[model samples]
Target chain A: MEAETFTLILDLMGTFAFALNGGLTAVRAARVDLVGVITLGMITAMGGGILRDMMLNVQPATFQDWRYLAVAAAGAFIAFAFSWVLHRMAIPIEILDAIGLSVFAVAGAIKAMNFGFGPVQSMILGTVTAVGGGTIRDVLILRVPSVLSEGLYAIPAFVGAALTVAALELELNGVAAAILGASVCWLIRVVGVYFKLNAPRPPRVEPGNLQG
Target chain B: MEAETFTLILDLMGTFAFALNGGLTAVRAARVDLVGVITLGMITAMGGGILRDMMLNVQPATFQDWRYLAVAAAGAFIAFAFSWVLHRMAIPIEILDAIGLSVFAVAGAIKAMNFGFGPVQSMILGTVTAVGGGTIRDVLILRVPSVLSEGLYAIPAFVGAALTVAALELELNGVAAAILGASVCWLIRVVGVYFKLNAPRPPRVEPGNLQG
Candidate 1:
């Protein structure tokens, strides 16, 4: 498969995953009606890409292309319709979310490079594309963004973006490169979730134990 | 003053307003450290313009220029240093926020028009530029976005953007047109706050009134 086609397929799948993730979160956390559910889902799926494109000085594909919107809407509606089943399958949702994260990170980085950004910028944008939507969704639902508090979130994304950049520099076949980058990201994320890994936290200070 | 200069001034003021508004909200609502306060402030100040630029398919001015960042940072630091006094002065903050909203609405619309978008697109982007940052800020603090639930948010922005488009069509002086558009929005928002106005809510449903 061509690299462009591969990236599109992975991106669409990632978008679907995030849409479901956002929709389910809204259903579980808020008293919003159907409009809210679909709206949150679309935002979750597309927000990161939109942010990435804006930084890259290009029109967001979400606004320009109808396919992205249609796919995201489908994901939201499906989640809403199957809320009962989804509610009972928390682990599956988490794994799907991880897949979305990895795909977006690699695709976002590739897109940034295509737009002529440097590797550092590509890596940053890749991470942003992976995590940006969830951050926005969390904020809309009035929660501290998990990106700021959660374990091993951005690390996998950065690594995946780096790998993609390296593959491109080496002129590897596009499909294989994308797959390798995404797989590395997916593995790290799955391990993090399964192991309940946490990034380092600030040291705890005991009350009334200030050192002189 | 040239229209360009006027627009720049208004945009800067709007940036400052949002930064202060965001920082003050953080101080009032969250137990975040200083870094949190500053980060929230910058996001609030810049989020709207970034959203607007993304929709317009242009580089976000916030990312391209340092002035916006410097102003937003100053606003955040000032808010942090005087949060105690600000907490006691809620009305002032609200007024400043209204100013920010009006200015950004007009500026964003004008920018869209400059970028060759249609009037409707300009109006939408304008409103997004006005309210987008605050929406992000509200979400970050774990609160329902006031724009969706509260007093006359999108309305004033729409009207302001429409007015700016109308002025441009009529070949009005740019500075005068901008001032007029922003003033109208500011007035409507101020009145809404003072009168405790709200958009229409869904009809109340009685709990436990299940019909067979």
Candidate 2:
């Protein structure tokens, strides 16, 4: 029970952070007004969980817990109220993106596993959790999804989730499993960025490039 | 075979018209430019079928019929080129909206029934089909869904589809059925607009109501 409460707090914090990042992105990209900023922020934080819950035929996690709304609203409020100062700050956007990625991966995998998903399904859930919100945000804002177009995005979460589910089957407790899971995901992601571990690309097949 | 070809042509025309409508809405909203118009147009035309297929665990209908893409692209092109003239024309938007609604409703119901869904499922499909494209477009544009919030949108389609399916059961043929289905939907929609039939508003919980 205590662990669940702690996890929920972490989840809410992650949501707030994600919302802040979304608001900042919206302002930078499309110059959204305050209402638009809040809407985008809320969507970026809660969109994936909503998708997961709807697909799984469960009540949406955000709707079930008022804390989710509070987190998102608070984040949006802060971002809207302090746009000038925050915009001038040297805060790295990538850090917020990383935090969003890690928290969502953990939350999504846990939710899926709780619903009795197998390791493969759990991994997919984790990937969805990590990237789904941003995907929705981009589509709504009429931008190509960053996940599909750039970066080594989904693979790390997939690997981390598979490891977490695997460790659980081997009888590890929750905290240790989370630390291990997050470590695997975070290490690979951080290293991949620094070292530029390129995702494989299928070269474009132009008509002139076709061989007989 | 000839009848199938005819239906196919009409379907493409209907798709083109709706795609244009979607593009015009975005342009009116002025959130994006050429790219935005095309993207929204494609989504509006194909979004319903995409949602249905995703829910049914099938590959999307647009993937099966590349003509959908052709029609969408053409519609977007026409809208982009002629938007200024169209916007200036004295023609009412309601006529085009009603036509789009009816066509989408019939298409959705037919597709669902053909896919072996029962009546209730078909009804659900009909409702989604008629308004799903518009709903998604509005969401992307960050406007309240016109269907869900200010109009007698979904209900008219629902009624029209029920009549069409019932007619089908009674051995009504293609031309007669299509006419009846479309007319029924359009008449209801026009009536709704003229007389303002809509769902009751949520209570006045919004702030600043007292200021007025």
Candidate 3:
């Protein structure tokens, strides 16, 4: 594969993993076969990028290209078909999630720059794009988004993407810059998960529990 | 009260009713408690508007004014407190829904215009803002959004908002023009519900009930 194509494959893999993550969450939520699973997968995979593009007055990059949809659909279909067996694999999914977070965050920042937004806005949008899909998934499933409630979920993506952009502005190659940023995001997520490094939860008063 | 404040009260009623509808949905889905309920209410009331404003490069109108948050919060509290009685009421949720649709669609369009978006984009954003919260809610919960799947849910808002903007541009007083547009939207919704109007459904194969 050409260099762009090689990078694109990693990007698609990340999308696939995110989509599968969304599908798994939907299954747990018992909203079986509602278009929610498919939508969730799509959102988790494409949501952040879509939000960034739309906000910057650009048509969604996914719409301009087709591979993103194919990857999301393929991932959800695979998960739906073999969920019984795949549910048992924990380590693979973990790795997939980390990769997805890093790639999506980097992609978000790059897209933002292409649309001419300032660096601060680009970083924020990139972080949002990276986690927005998962956040939407959790909220719809009536769970607090892990990004909002969990530790350091979106922050590392911001840091890495911002640093990568700064390096590129200092004349780094685009591919090298993206890989560098993606690595930074991935390392942070892996450490946060394995080491229990996460954000502090807000104090919440429990309401009187109603028996469902 | 000043005319604007009077209209604002009416606007608050619309927000209250809209948030109540969202809270009730969460309840019916068997999810409860204050945090989730409040979040749901806020999402339903402001999701669409936030998306619209962000796209238009303006801060969301709701976050700018505290009244919007207060109305949605109070609405959620009321819904939580009296859900049983409200659920048992003879009238359908559609009645509250119609009132909400009218107020939100009008308010969203007006806000967009105030931010100086062009006629086309303002109408588009207004329609999205009115339904955007619910869309995000459905996507998160993994259900097919009513706007995308249920047919005609958002079109009325689009039409009404477009008309409202056009009339305003034609030198109609803002209040009179908005009222006219809202009534048109309200009537469309009422008629659609009464007549069971529906949009096109996506093509799909049913699971395993096929005749051999």
Candidate 4:
């Protein structure tokens, strides 16, 4: 497959993953009606991309492209309908969430680079794109965002973004580059979760009560 | 002053108001370091404008302009330095917040109209611009955003945006029109606070509360 097509597919997959994650979170957060559930789901799916576009001084791709909206809506609807089942499938949800984070980080970085941003800026934007929606989701549900408080979350995204940027710099902007970037991110995230690894915390400060 | 200058002044004032509001909220929310406070303040001040620009498919004005950043940063710094006094000055902070909401709503609507969006779209963008940052701030602090939960918040913004759009439609896009739109929004918001007026809630549902 063409590199662009591959990246696009990954982006769509990530969007679907985030939509499910967001919908499930909404179900857990409140006794919100259908509007609330769908709203939260859409926000979770598209919020990061919107923010990334704003930072890059471009129109949000999700708004311009119908596919993104359709996939996100479908994913959200499915999650909402299967809330009972999803509520009991925490491990699977976590795995999907990690995949979403990995692919989004790489895709966001590549997009930033395509927009002529430098590597550092691209990496930052990539990480933001990966985690921004979940941050927004956590906030809406009245919890401190895991990015700031939790273990090994932002780090994996940063690593993925950096790898993508490095690959582009090495003239490796192909499927191999994308796979390498995403694999590093996903593997680290999964291992981190399995081992309960944490990023360094502040000296002697009590950890936040929220789980990662 | 030229109408453009008048609108610019109001936009800057709104940025300052949101910065203070966001900074103060951060101070109250957690034992965040200085970076956290300033980051939250800037997001609160600029998030609306960024969202507006995205809807209009243009670069955010805040990113292109330095004055907005400076004003927002100053407001945040002041709030951080004087958290004790600001914490006790809740009434004043609220008034400033109302001013911010009104001006942002009007400015956003006008800008969207200038960019050639239809009236309905302009009004929605305007209201989003007014409340978007505060919504982000609330989420960051892990609270349900005031726009979604509180009384008369989104209403004032919508009213201001509608007035601004109406003014443009009536060919009254001048200082008088700007003043009219902003004043109406500010007055209603201040009055809403005084009377404790709430926007219509979903019937009979207990408000989900997390301590402010």
Best by TM-score: 1
lDDT of candidates 1 onward, in order? 0.84, 0.73, 0.76, 0.83
Candidate 4 segments whose C-alpha is farther than 4 A from its true place: A1-110, A116-124, A136-142, A150-212, B1-6, B29-39, B66-82, B140-142, B199-212
Task: Write model 4 residue lDDT over B87-181, tens digit each, in one string.
Answer: 77889889988989999988888888888889999899989999999887777877778788878988988998898788878998456676788
Q: What is the CAPRI rating of model 3's predicted complex?
A: incorrect
What is the per-residue lDDT of model 3 for residues B1-212, given as tens digits with 9 covering 90 to 100? 77688678767877887788887777677455777777887788778778777665667778989989999898887778888887875256777777777777888888878876667656766777778888876665556566644545677787888889999899998888888988898888888778878743323334565553
Winning model by DockQ: 1
TM-scores for all candidates: the values are: 0.61, 0.54, 0.57, 0.61
**What is the per-residue lDDT of model 1 for residues A77-111, given as tens digits with 9 covering 90 to 100?**
77777776788888988888888999999889989
DockQ computed for model 2 against the true two-chain complex using alpha carbons: 0.04
TM-score of 4: 0.61
- Cα lDDT for residue A18, candidate 1: 92
**TM-score-sorted candidate list, best first:** 1, 4, 3, 2
- Ordering by DockQ: 1, 4, 3, 2
The residue pairs that clash in candidate 4, if any, are A139-B139, A142-B142
Which model is ahead, 3 or 4, in terms of DockQ?
Answer: 4
Per-residue lDDT of candidate 2, residues A18-45 (tens digit): 7887776666666355545666777789
TM-scores, chain A, per candidate: 0.92, 0.87, 0.89, 0.91
